[model samples]
Target chain A: MTLALTLDNASVLIFALTGALAASRAQLDVVGFIFFAALTAVGGGTLRDLLLDRDPVFWIADATPLAIATGAAVLVFFTAHLVESRLKWLIWLDAAALAIAVAAGVSVARSMEVGTGVVLVMGVATGTFGGLMRDVVANEVPLVLKQGELYVTAAVAGAGAALIASLLADGTIWTTVACIATTFGLRAGSLLFGWRLPVYKPRPPRA
Target chain B: MTLALTLDNASVLIFALTGALAASRAQLDVVGFIFFAALTAVGGGTLRDLLLDRDPVFWIADATPLAIATGAAVLVFFTAHLVESRLKWLIWLDAAALAIAVAAGVSVARSMEVGTGVVLVMGVATGTFGGLMRDVVANEVPLVLKQGELYVTAAVAGAGAALIASLLADGTIWTTVACIATTFGLRAGSLLFGWRLPVYKPRPPRA
Candidate 1:
């Protein structure tokens, strides 16, 4: 097994955990939680594959991610209370997951030589949109649309960093790692400090 | 407008209405209902386009479907009770929507000369998956998944019928119409006679 494969699997686990956490909070049954977990874990990759016109959609092609996601969901079902007990650590874990997803998406897109803009947008989408879909499916307002800690903005910035690294370095592993670190650091800081975006308000009525 | 264009636009309107109807039944706000309408209407086509690697993703390329969906959503918001108040008639209208969507999807798949298996799946997907997505997004159990009429099954059958019809004919308008009729008739019969798949009950506990 390689570092990339390890990170990929970890990313899938993180993705599954997000859904499992949300589902457990919603008090869904095991089946429901697993369904949401599966959707959250592979939903973005599936969309990416479909948009890329690739066959067998990645999750369907390799069952590893699905297996991991199902396992994560089951684990969360039994141990949700334990994880919830550690409320302070949850934000950092979420930030880690978001950063990893962004980095992974950027890596794959650049490897495929997709255009810069597509790469950036798709990376942000892959990182944040799965959770967005998860929240939407779970009947909650999407975090991206709300006044959250600039989660998607962080993803976009991370994606930009990855793109720059890819363009500058001659396929060096350090470059990729550096980009991932940049994204992860930004997200972790935002989460720890409760950072937020400026709110948009309607203009005052004319006299 | 060309016949193909008419069929395409009609399919969009029908599916959009189906989504609007579902959202209304859920008592979603106007914006929420409009979102559901657009998702239910264009979601299948958008997925299809993505799978085929078609650029602009359909709705983003053509403003007509989006505009049409918005208009339909507005119309449904004002007249939702008109449909929701009558459960039976609305079911038939939804069936009609399924019919049109299946027909349109089959026609487009033929134009692409996609593989038979993928085409069949895509046709059914284009017909009913949007509604499934809407139900998931609206945080409700999908009607098709419950003890309801065979919606997706009928859609698949209709799509298969259209493919076969296209093969037998010159992809004539009659073939499409016949396919649509097959879908609608089957769904209508299901509604009128309570035709449904057998429920999967848990096996009796071993003695």
Candidate 2:
């Protein structure tokens, strides 16, 4: 398999696992785990494709990702109790998946020759949307929009890096490496060191 | 403009109002209100389009619905307090919007010459997805999936009616009326008198 496809598959697996973990934490049924897992694995790419007016959507065109995601969900469902803390692991897994997904998204958009703005938007959307959907489905506030953490920023930076790298002479490999590294590194740092964006404190009600 | 377009626009307005109400209740800022409103207004149609592989997604092709949603959001942001209770009105508005959205979705799918199953699924997705996204973004369980509600059932019945009506000779008007009546009647009934599906009670953990 090509490096891009390999990374994409890995991201799908990680994302599906995170989704299943969330489902387990929510005490959802087996169907719920599979549904959420598939949703999380494909939701972002689906959105990106729809927005770009891409036909057949990624998952519908190739069912392999769907199969992989469903299998991962089943495995996670059976082994959830063995994992001491599901939510924590889910977050970490999502972080790893986000990096790879962002790179994939940026690559797709870049290949389409869309403008930089569109490419950057697609990349961030591809990375963060799955987790956002997962959190929404699992009934938690989306971590990307929360007061704590720098998740979307990481995605933005990675997407931007990819876009910039694509302009370089030796851009493809560098774009992939930069996008993944920047996103994963920032997200992992946040998990390890509690990195956060400044809270948006509303001004006191006018007297 | 076509009847479908008119109904779609009306749905967008109502859905946007509901989304803005949810944002207000969540104490989100102006940007949040607009963001959530657009997401709620377009979420369902976007999903349906992607699943059906329809080009231009709907809101993207014509910016009017988007403009309407954003305007509604801003208006709600400024005048939320005038509504007495946002959540109560939001639910009722959502019910009305859902019926119209379902009809529009069914019409689109029928025009595409897709199968009954695909049409029905698209209709339900169009009807309920906006509300689901709104609730999720507002950090509440999606009311469509929640127990003690006939939300999805209403959508299914409406979509089914539309599909059945379409098979009849000279069925366009009948299809629209049937779709609207089935969905609105059920939803309004649910609001006026507590109509709900059987709750799923889990068996206690195995010994």
Q: Which candidate is the best by lDDT?
A: 2
C-alpha DockQ of every model: 0.07, 0.13
Off by over 4 Å in 1: A1-7, A85-91, A146-148, A195-207, B1-20, B23-129, B136-207
- Candidate 1 chain A — worst ten consecutive residues by lDDT sum? A82-91
Reference-based lDDT, each prediction: 0.70, 0.81
Q: How well is each residue in A107-174 modelled by candidate 2, as lDDT tens digits?
A: 77776645565677678778878888898767787875554466776887898888777778444589
Chain A of model 1, TM-score against the native? 0.88
Q: How many backbone clashes does candidate 1 have?
A: 0
Tell how far residue B42 is off in model 1, in angstroms: 8.0
